[model samples]
Target: MSEAGKANKARSGGRSGGRAARRTLRTTRDFRMLPGLTRNIPYCEVMDEAHVERLDNASMNILENVGVHFRDPIALEDWKTAGAKVVGERVFLDRGLVRELIRTIPAEFTYHARNPANNVRLGGPHSIFVPMTGAPFLRDLDNVRRNPMLEDLATFHKLAHMLPALHSTAHHIVEPYDHPISQRHLRITYSSMMHSDKMFMGMTTSPKNAEDVMEMCAILFGEDYLEDHPVTTGNCNGNSPLVWDETMLGAMRAFCRRNQPVLCSPFVLGGANTPASVPAAVAQLNAEALSALAYTQVIRKGCPAIYGHYLSTVSMRSGAPMAGTPEIGLMNFMIGQMARHYGVPWRTSGSLGGAKTFDAQAGYESASTLSAVIHAGANYIWHAAGWNEAGMHCSIAKFVVDAVQCAMAHRLGEGPKWDDFDQALSAVPDVGPGGHYLGHPHTQENFQSAFFMPELFDNNSIEQWVADGEKEITERALNHARNLLSEYQQPMLDVARDEALRDYIARREREIPAASELNQSY
Candidate 1:
C-alpha cells in the first residue's frame, strides 16, 4: 500500500471508534438542569469611576431635590419614620440614609428550590436565567399566536423544567385569559410549583395575591423553613418617573416581612418615563431602585432585595418601545456598575426583542440583549427566553433557541478551562507539520466538553441537511421543544404537601371574586 493509504487504514479504526463513543455519549446524555452560572469573567463596565460617581451624585440629587412620590400612605409613613423628609406623598431622601439602608442588603443569598439540586445562589458573581414572564400572548408550537390558557402556562413550566439551561420557570410565562383574573394568580402559582421544583417568582398583582403566593410557598416548604431560607421572589415594578404606588408597596411589604426577596424593578420607557439621554435615564432609574431597596429595609431590617429594572427606549417616530437598542445595552452596563457600587445584587431583562416573528430581526435583537445582560454581570436575568414582540408574546421556538443561547452564555461566563491544558498541548507534537488532530487521542477525549454543541442549531453539510428535510431554525426549535415536553416529568412532591397546596388554591379560588364580578382592566 502507498504511505498515504497505509496512514488512512491505520487511522480508520480509531476514527470509527471515536464516532461510536460520541454517538453513545449523545444518546445517553443526562439532561439535569444547571444549578446556576458562576461568572469567572470580569464584568463589562461602561462608566469609569468618575462617570459612575457622577451618575451616583446625579441620582442622589434627584432623590434629595425632586424626591420620589410614595403614593401609598403606608410607604410615606415608613419613609418618614426611617428619617426621610416626607412632604405629603413625596419623600426626600438624604444620600447618607440611602447608603445606610442599602448596607443591610446581603451581597449574596441562597435561593432555595424544592429540589435541593436546583437551589441557586443569587448575587455576587452568580447568575441565574429566568424565563420571560407576564406575556399576555403565546406563539404555540404550531406557530399560532393566541391568548394562552392555563394548560399553555403549565406546558411552558414543563418545558422550562426539561431545558437544562434555564434556572427558573418564572411565574406567568403567559397570561391565562381563560381563567378568572382574580383567581389566575393561584392557578399560576400552583402550576409553577407542581411542574418545576426550581426557585421561582410569586404574583405581585395585589397584596392579597402576594400573601396567597407566600402562603402556598409556606405549604410547599414549611413556614418555619421559609422564614430563614429565601424561596420565591416578588417583582414590585415601580411606576416610572419616581413614584411607588400602594399596589406595589403593599406587595413589597408582604414579601419583605416574610424575609423573602423582592425585585424592586422600575418599568421604564426612556424619553417617556425619564430623560431621553441614557445617563439621565439611568440616574432617575437608580434613584427609583434605591428608594425601593430602602423600603425593603423599612419593611423589615436586613430583608433580601434585588436592584432591578426593565428599561427600554422609545421610538421617536411611533412612540413604541424599542428593545436591544445600543442605549439599552449601555444602560445595562451602567446599572451593573451602580448596583455593585451600592453592594447589592441586581436584575435586568435579557433576550428582549421587538420583532413580531422569530426571524432575523428577532435573533439579532435577542442576541444583542442577552449578550449585554451577561456582560453586565446581572445576577437575575429575567426575560432570558421567549421574549418577543416588545414583550407582548412568548414564542415556543424562540424559548428553545434562547435557552440554548443561555447555555452557551453560561459556558462563556465560566471562562477558560485549564484542567487538560497539558494533555491538549501534548497533541500538537503527536500530529506533526501539515497533520490534523482529528484522530488524536486528546481530541477524541475532549471533543464533547471542548465546544458548545447547540441542540437547536444545525451545523452539517448541505447534502446532510437536505437529507434531513432542510428545516429552518424555528421549525427545528419547535420540534425540539415538542420532544422536551414529551420527556418532561413532573418534579416529585410529597403527597400531603401537594394536597395542601391544592386545597389552599381551591379555597382562595372560592374566596376571591370572579373576574366577571369585578373590573376587567386587571
Candidate 2:
C-alpha cells in the first residue's frame, strides 16, 4: 500500500470510533440512456466495450480530419517533426497517431487533498471532488462594493481549509500581495504546500504560469514520486475551441510524461461558442476530446486524462451564462455517459444555483444539478458549492447548503439494497400486517441505523415550521454554515511547519516585482 493509503486507513479506523460503519451502497441497475433531455442528443453509450470502440474511432476522426491548431511556434515544429500536418500554426493529427497515444494512457490515479482525510481516488470506478473558493475575493455581505484588495490569500486559504466537501481547492482568487506574472503560479504552489495536501494545478490560458506552478510541485514531491504514486497533482481547463495553442500543448505534454491527470473543461456557451441546438453542443464536446486526447497521447503514450464538459446556457436577453439551467444539468448527465463510453474518466459542474438572493432557486438548482451528476456517475465534480452569478462569486451560506446536498447525493448514490434491509419478513414474525413496528425490537434495531436521514430537511408539519420561526431552507442553511464555521478548528499544522510556510511566501513575495510595478512604463 502507498503511504497515503496507510495514513487513510489509520485515520478511518480512529474516526469510526469503534462503531461498525455502514457499508457503501452499490447498485445492480443497468445504465439507461436518457434522450431529448437536452437538444444535445448524446449518441447513447455507456461503459460497454462496443461503445469504447466507437469513441476511439470518433477521436481518431477528430485527430485526422478536424485537426487542432497550435499557436506556439515550438509546439508547431514539434508536431511537424512527429509527422503531423502543420499548416501555418495548425497541427493536423492522423488517426493512427491518436490510437497509439490513447493506448498509452493510464486508466486510474489518486489525488491527495490538503486534508489527508479528504484525498480522493480519481479513476477506475466513479468518484467526485467538489469545487470551492474561486472568486476574485471573499465578498463582504454587508457592503455590495467589490474590492479586489479586500481579502488576503491566507483568508481564502483558511476558508478552503474549512470546507468539508471541497476535496481540492483551486487558487482562491487573485491576491493583491503577489506579482501578476508569477502571482497565479506562486499562489497555487503556496496554497498546495501550505493549506492543501493535494492540488489542482494549471491555468487555462497561461502556459508559463502552468510550468512554474508545476515545477514547484515537482520540486516538493520529487519527480520520481510524481511518476510512481502520481497522487499529488492534476491539470485543468485547456478550454474547448479544442485547439491546443503551443503553450497549452507543451504543458500537457510535460504533465502527461509524469503520468499526472489533466482535465478538459470545455466551457460551451450555448448560443455563442456552439450551435444553439443541444446536438451541436455535444459536437463541441467531441471537439474538446479531439484536442485533449491528441495532446495526452503525444506528450506521453497513454497519459491519464478526464473528459470534462460545462454547458452553461447563455441568456439571450442578459448575454450571461445561465449556470442553473436545466440544459446544464442534462448536459452534465450526457457528458458522463460520453466519457464512460470512451473508457476515460469524466467530471462536471455541481451545486451552482443561479439565484441572486441565496434563496430557494439556489437550493433547488444546486441540488437538482448535483443529483443528476452524482446519479450519472461523474468521476470529478467542480463548483460543487459556494458559487453565484455563474462563478463570479462564492457565498459561504450557499457553500454550506451545497455541502450537505453533496453528502446527501453521496448517500443516495449508494442506492437502496438488501444489505441495507437487514431483517427478513420471517425474522419479524411478531409484527403482523398493519401492526405498529415503532416500538418493536426490529424497529429499534434498524430505524436510526438503516437510513441516511438528514438533520436540516424538515419533515415536520407546517405548524412546527411556523412555531420554529418559519425558517426557510436558506435560513437553515445559513445557520448550518455559521455553526460549521464556528465549530471547525483549523486542521493541524505544526508551529515549525507554519513558520516555514510563512517565511517561504514572504521570501518569494520580496523577490518578485509587484503587479503594478511590472506593468508600469519606465
Candidate 3:
C-alpha cells in the first residue's frame, strides 16, 4: 500500500457523535492495490479451451467476412496498406494480421501521475478505478438534480482527488452546462490537471480537444518526458455493429500517435445495439473491439490500447438500455478472457446501473456488476462511483457508497494473506477449552489490519447508532462526501506550469470557432 492508504485512518467523520472515532489502522501493504502498487497473481479464468477458441474464431469471421465500417478515409488507407481488403468504408482484416499486430503492443506499461510516487501500471493483474464520467446532470443528496455548473465540475475533481480509492478520473466528471459547449472541454481538462495529482482521461469530444489535452500534459510532464511516459487515456467508443465514426477515429489518431492509450470500447446494449444472446453479443463486441484495436496499431504500432466492452440488456418495454444486468456480467467475463487471449490490457464497466435514485435497485445493480469486475481480474474500471439513471446522472450519495465498495473489492481481489499463519494458529492453544480469543494477544495484534475498514458504513452498536440520529446509509454518504470535499487540498504544481496550462486553454478557446462539427456531444 502507498502512504496514502495510511491517511484514510488519520480521520473519519459523518457519524452522529460529536465526531466519530477514526479508525487508527496500519496500511494493508500485502493485500491492497493502493494508488501506486502492482498486482502479481494469475488472473482467474471463466472459459475453457473450446469456449475461448469458439469466441475467437467467431470474432475473426466477423472482421474478415462482414467487416467493420471505417468512416475516415485516412483510416481506410492505413488499413489498405496493411494488406486488408477495403471496399468503400468497410475494412476486412486478415486474422493473422490482427494477431501479429496485437503482439506488438506491450502487455504492461506505467501511466505516470503528476506525483512520481503515484505512477500506476496498466495491463497488469491489478484493477484501476475511476469516477463516473460524462453525466450531464448532477444529483445531490437532497434529490436536487440539475445541469451542473462549472464550479460543480471542479468540486467533483477535488472530491475525486481526496478519495483514496480513485486512482484517476474521466475528464468530464459532469458536463459543465453553465459554459458554452465550445469552451466546456477547455475548462474540464484544465480543472482535472489543476486539482488532481493522479492520472486522468483525456478529452474525446473532438480532435481539437485531443490536441489541447496533449498540450496540457506536455506542460506538466515536459515534451521529451512524455515520449516515454503516458499520463492519461481516452475512451473511444465504436458505433456498434462494426463501425467507427469520424470524431472517434480523429481522437484516436491524436492520442495513439502520441504514444498514449485509447480504450477501444463498443457501446453495446444486448438486443438493442447487439444480439440478445450473450455469446452472439460477445462475438459482436469482440469484432467491434478488434476494429478499434487494429486501427490504433495501424496508426502507431505498439501504442498502448485497452480492449473495452460495455454490454447491457435492453428494457423490452421501453427500449432503454439496462446496466448491471445478468447478461452484462457474463459479457464482462468473456471480455476478460478475450483480452487475455490477445495479451492486452482489459477495461470494463463498474458500479453501473439504470436506477433513478440511490435505493435498493441501484445498490443491487452496482453490487452484482462490481463483483464480476473483481472476479474477472479487470485492469481498468470507469464509472466506478456515482453513475446512475442510465448514465444520465452522477449522484453524490452513490459516489461515496461506491468508494467504499471499490476499496473493499481491491482488498478482496487481493485474496487473503498466508504470511505468519503459524502465529495465528499458535494462539489456538490459548483459546482451547471454549475460551474466547477476542482478548488473546494474536487477536489484539491483528484486529486493526486484519480486515477492510469501510469509510462510510456504520459498524457501531444499535444503541449508539440510534443515539447518533439513526441516519440512513445514503444520508451518511452525503455527509461523508461533504467532509471529503471540505478537506481537499489542491495538488502542488510549479506556478509557471500552472500559468502555462491556463494560457494554453485560453488560447485554444479563443482560436477554436464557437461552432464546429464535433461539438454536438458536449
Best by lDDT: 1
Predicted model with the maximum TM-score: 1
- lDDT for model 2: 0.59
Candidate 2 residue lDDT tens string, 1-522: 999776556544444332222232222221111110111112323346664456556655665777666777777776776678988866677866655555555556666544445556765464665555456533333314254442344444444455544555555443333446445456555664665444444443345445555555555555576765554434445445655555556666656667777776666788777778664566566666656765666666666787766667889998887766767766665566666655677767777766665667777777777767776677777778677656666665566566667666665665555663546454466867544444455645665546656656785556869999998766776675555445534455556655655565566667656665352211
155, model 3: CA deviation in Å?
1.6
Candidate 3: clashing pairs of residues: none
Runs of candidate 3 with Cα error greater than 4 angstroms are 1-33, 36-44, 515-522
Worst 10 residues of 2 by lDDT: 30-39
**Predicted candidate 1 versus true structure: per-residue lDDT over 1-522, tens digit per residue:** 899776766566356665655674666446698869999998999888999999999999999999999888888888878899999889999999999999999999999999999999999999999999999999999999999999999989998888888999899999998888888889999999999988888999888889998999999999998889999999999999999998899999989999999999999999999998999999999999999998899889898999999989999999999998999999999999999999999999989999999999999999998998899999999999999999999999999899999999999899999999898998888899766676677777777889888878886556879999999999999998888877777888899999999899888777777964372223
lDDT rank, highest first? 1, 3, 2
| Of 1 and 3, the candidate ranking higher by TM-score | 1
Q: Supply the TM-score for candidate 2.
A: 0.79
Note the residue pairs that clash in candidate 1. Answer: none
